[model samples]
Target: MAMTQAVQPVIRPATQPTTPARHVTVRGRASFWLFGAAACVALLVLLPLAFTLRQALGFGAANAAELVFRPIVGELALNTLMIVAAATVTSAIVGAAAAWFVERTHLPGRKIWAVLAAAPLAVPPFITSYAWVSFSESLQDFNGALLVVTTAYYPLIYLPVAAALRGMDPALEETARSLGLGPWTRFFRVVLPQLKPALLGGMLLVALGTLSEFGAFALLRFRTFTTEIYAEYRLSFDGSGASMLASILMLLCLVCLALEFRVRGLSRYDRMDRGARRAPARYHLGWGKWPVLASFAGLTLVTLGMPLGMIVYWLLQHGDAAITPVEVSLPLVLDATLSSVGLGLAGAALTTVLALPLGLLLARHPGRIATLLERIVYLAQGLPGIVIALAIVSLAIQALRPLYQSAALLVVAYAILFLPLALVSVRAALLQVEPRLEDAARSLGLNRWQTLWRVVLPLAGPGLGCAAALVFISVMTELTATLLLAPIGTQTLAMQVWADTAALAFAAAAPYAAILVGFSLISTWLLMSLFGKTAVLGATS
Candidate 1:
């Protein structure tokens, strides 16, 4: 969902000659070093996929088939597929409509509405699940899971589509209007076709997200592959069963990725000439204004209001004034908050640092090797955190025993899980740093390392900060990997929320949930301030 900046055509004076290549040997050597570094990072990122494949293969084919073909597997598959399909469709419709109203129509306070639409990303899906379940036990089923995930993930589609709407050229729509086409016809025929890439990309993200989601479904008691895999691992330590399930989930995600990629095939919709383009005229709501406002009001109420209202309700219930009051400990809450902040900072720094080499390579030295390495990094996006945690646990126990159950090991898992997030920001940041600046630095007798340190890094400082902050927010809210891999006796806010919520102690969970939500909101605001609305897309997806 990261909006790509258009490439400005480089115009040179007619008298200026084409620049000669200088320091070809130095560049060649630098490229080789960068390639080696990036390859190592890619291999580390590929470990989970490799491990899953190995475990599945080690389970004999007949036995694996039997395990996968059982009635329970079929049931889980159906539930997972149903939820993924429903959520993807629901999110698309809701997201697209929200984007249309916010970006294409004359909605009052459109800017505020845009921010509010993406705000759900700040609330972890599990917290949303906790809120709904605490509100009523009857919601512990398919419908509950659908509602929670739709609210949580619609922004995955909305952000990208809205960004697309903002970037699109209005010339085609104007021509269609001139030809007497109705608004609906123009939208479907002209606008929809142009938005295909962003829309499909967003839908792909929603499907993959729903398919791999763990905590939310677990809390909701919705039996999906992720939940089943977690259960198999935790209850029976059934590595083969869990690996087989994970493999199936990964395959589904891959299919979505491939489908979106194939459908989007080399499409370029950028303007061809250096012509001035004006913003598209907003559609007047007219008599529909009141209804449209009501719709937006209702949306914000459900998506933002409900979970927040529930959290506050639970917080207030933590005393003798309420029935079944639970005593909330301020010390425990503060400890967990501090722990979460510490771990988030550590994980953010480590992940961003690990991602730097690959991002640099992709931005400055793109080729077959760089592209392949990038694709390998992105393959992690398809893997759920549970699967990665499983792989890391197994690898650490079997090979890296000393690091097993260590904070360092957990941080490594965070790096692998969220590397793409950091990479996207890093690459985008580096891309904005003109190569001409580096060339000039070199011409001034600065070495490659010195040029990057003194020139490039400073220029990319804010983006790098954004990258780290994005990862920090994710680490703070991340439940799956932290649950499986955090060091003994360590309790973060996410763990506390999950623990109390799982025990049906919603009041006890409120403090942690509130702090977590607060951090997310603040961090989200910082991201928007730094990179605008499109940056929020990278924060989650």
Candidate 2:
């Protein structure tokens, strides 16, 4: 009866769906810009590779083949492969064992042992070579190269593997135990498979480091592709030969990368259940505790104790000297230290900035394009510093004349060389940030830029810090690129150490080396303590 009065139902205006469309538009623009930025970064890193290829191609097929297939090339390749293989295997064993002891067992002083285990990374491989060479000339061969690199880089494996161990759910191990699996059997069957991604990534880095190593192999008199490439560049000043060699080196690195990627496959290792994870129970060492303690003690002594002891010993020896060629003056040491710190900060900041776009694209918009860009950036890791430096020198001389012989150019080289380091850490950090948080922020009417600036940046800050710190440590110890690209009179600590060491002025080099090592130690401690279980070396999947 009331409807007869024509009481029409009050209709609310249709809610506008413009918000989602606007969000989509903003996100689409952001992704487009991110792809552009990442593509630029990847192309910048590809310069060295492209240059090397061009130089190699300039040689006709016959000449290229001859250069590549010669006995010297074969010998260098053999030496490179042998050392990379041996060092990778040795590092894997030591790293996996050390991580297991520190993480899975109730070994006394486990925390101290963990720090000690990772501390060797603080000492650069070249510095380790110097220390070992100073300790005994017997170390100036393949065995010495093996020991030095293994010690310096095992921590690359150890850090990531330890992080994996810490994060792994214990339910699988418990199930294995219940099924009558022995410790060794369980580890071989279950734990090892879970460790594949981390282990493969670590091994890839180890192989690449060994492959591209120049300073360490040079100091040790080991003639790998890197050292030989350096010699080619130095002697001829014509990059044709060097580029050919670098092409071979790059080929080897690509092989390692491809194998690692293929072997890593698509297997996901995360836990299936959505339950709060408890810490894995530590195995009691019991009567084995004494032996485990002794082993860790020995490992620590070799990896950390020896390097520091040698550094200090050299410092004391230098202090007692009367007429050193390069006088180890307090002012000189301080100046070099300041230069190193300043350059390190610059390089770290610049590299992290350049790495951000690639990292972001890979993290949020992964696809064939993003994946290819990431691979291209990672290819820079395979480039020897000398190669990258020379490429930059050529690029600068030809086109960027203003940047030639400039610190800005050197910093750019650092960015190109270490983009992978920063990208890995940055991507890892971003992956930990839940995308839902960004979505929630958007739902609250925040613009895309606002969501990123307010929510994503804050969440990713620590990882970015870690990335910068990692790059800082690397740039501090970098030798080849610094040697080529440093503005004249810049005088970094690494340069000072290289100069003195090459001149056989070990005493003069000691002060610089000690200061460098000290900075590294402090940084390493911070990374381990502040970023607990964070894999600074990187991870796969």
Candidate 3:
């Protein structure tokens, strides 16, 4: 009886997990995962970078001299800058004010506006650009790209900035407003300054996105480093030109990183404390509501409605050009869907898990190394999928030849390209965790790991999961890298879409396109669930 009781008590302790270490597990990552992820990232970034520099240098200073001396570089540079500038400026104006209006104002349908602003994000920028190119005579060139991208990307600003504004204590704005400050003055003086970092951070995402964009630029015939690089690679088969263009892109990416830092400054913008949430006061949108509605309506019509309507219209018009399920092959579509979903989920989890370390470091250790690593991530974000794809190709062949041209290699590419997204979200969430709570956990006989798992993680865990889901959805839609890096015999929906479209079989491409959009919408719905109910918002123009 004594022995039985002792064994039973021990079993209970094991089951109950009396300590944090006993309860939490840090295992599950295989050696292949750790070494593979690290190796893949190194190979994906370094090899292409080195090879690209080699090719760029092979221009023997004469070609580069021509590049500098000629107007080609200047024209491309000006165009690039113009698009980025327009996208950034438009996104800032629309996103910031909309976030402010929704979060602070007593505007009827604030919830509705919040949903509409974010809805555009779900409609891929390229898809929007595609609609503009096909339908509107005026929507082309630099302005069209800006309009398309801004509509799609502005949500990046709205979501975070609105969240920030919602958590902001109304006391600051109220205090400012009470001091004889008019509406415009108080907003400019108090709110704008306060939201600067958030605004800039969102704008940085837009800028990098514009820099790395390929599909929209290709569709619109707008020349950019990414589009040029791809054209050189696939169309011309000129690796030299591709590398040269990629080098320019890298330079642009570095500039974007510098700008992001300048905009974000040194402040940590995430404030996810569990304390009582204070809501910002609204600026009554009485007379100003018309301008708000007009601006908002114009954007919603062009950005949201027109693109979706175009997609639907194309489907209807081409409906007679019906692609039988047998013709398109549901099995093929299923395979692509499964591949996309599985890899997207796996990559999202891996990237999110990997990003936790960097995020924690950024939150706690803001030293040069941490800053440098963070900068590297942001710089990587500006890299086109094709560049990352080409880099991985070189690295895979050289480093891990056995793993080369495998699903594992493709997943690694996805992880590297999308890791930064997970990092940003994790960092954003980490910024919200207070050190005091962690210190309190330590006082309760917990070590750093214990404190993180028991306290910090429990609080930040939701954000991490949300971040992972977001990554998964994005990778599922990713076309460029998947096109180059997906091993032989691997067929993804993105590749199928590209192939069908390239073959000029719009009817054949319809199923794949529909499937992609369906998946995108579903994934988007999942993501919006994190914030709240967000539906497609707009009126057709």
RMSD values, in order shown: 7.5, 3.9, 8.9
* Candidate 3 residue spans exceeding 4 A from truth: 1-51, 54-59, 66-71, 134-138, 235-238, 263-278, 319-332, 356-374, 397-404, 425-464, 499-507, 528-541
Clashing pairs in 1: none
| C-alpha lDDT of residue 140 in model 3 | 70
Per-residue lDDT of model 1, residues 1-541, tens digit only: 2233222223344445544434777788888888888999999999878998898889898989898899999999899889989999999999999999999999999999998999999999999998898888899889999999999999999999998998888888999999999999999999998888888888988998998798899899999999988888887664677888888888888888888889889978777783685898899999998998898899899888999999999888745533345567778888899989998999999988888888889888888989999999998887788888888887887889999989999989999999999999899888778888899999999999999899988877778888998999999999998988888889999998888888787888888899999999999878767675335433432
Candidate that would win on lDDT = 1
lDDT of 3 by residue, 13-103 (tens): 6676545554233222322243344344444444555666776788667767765556766788888888988888888888888887778
Q: Rank the candidates by TM-score, best first.
A: 1, 2, 3
lDDT for 61 (candidate 2): 88
Overall lDDT per candidate, in order of appearance: 0.87, 0.84, 0.70
Give one digit per residue, the lDDT tens place, for model 2 in 135-180. Answer: 8878888999999999989998998999899988888899999999
Report RMSD for candidate 3.
Answer: 8.9
Pitting candidate 2 against candidate 3, the one with the higher lDDT is 2
TM-score, per-candidate, Cα-based? 0.92, 0.89, 0.76
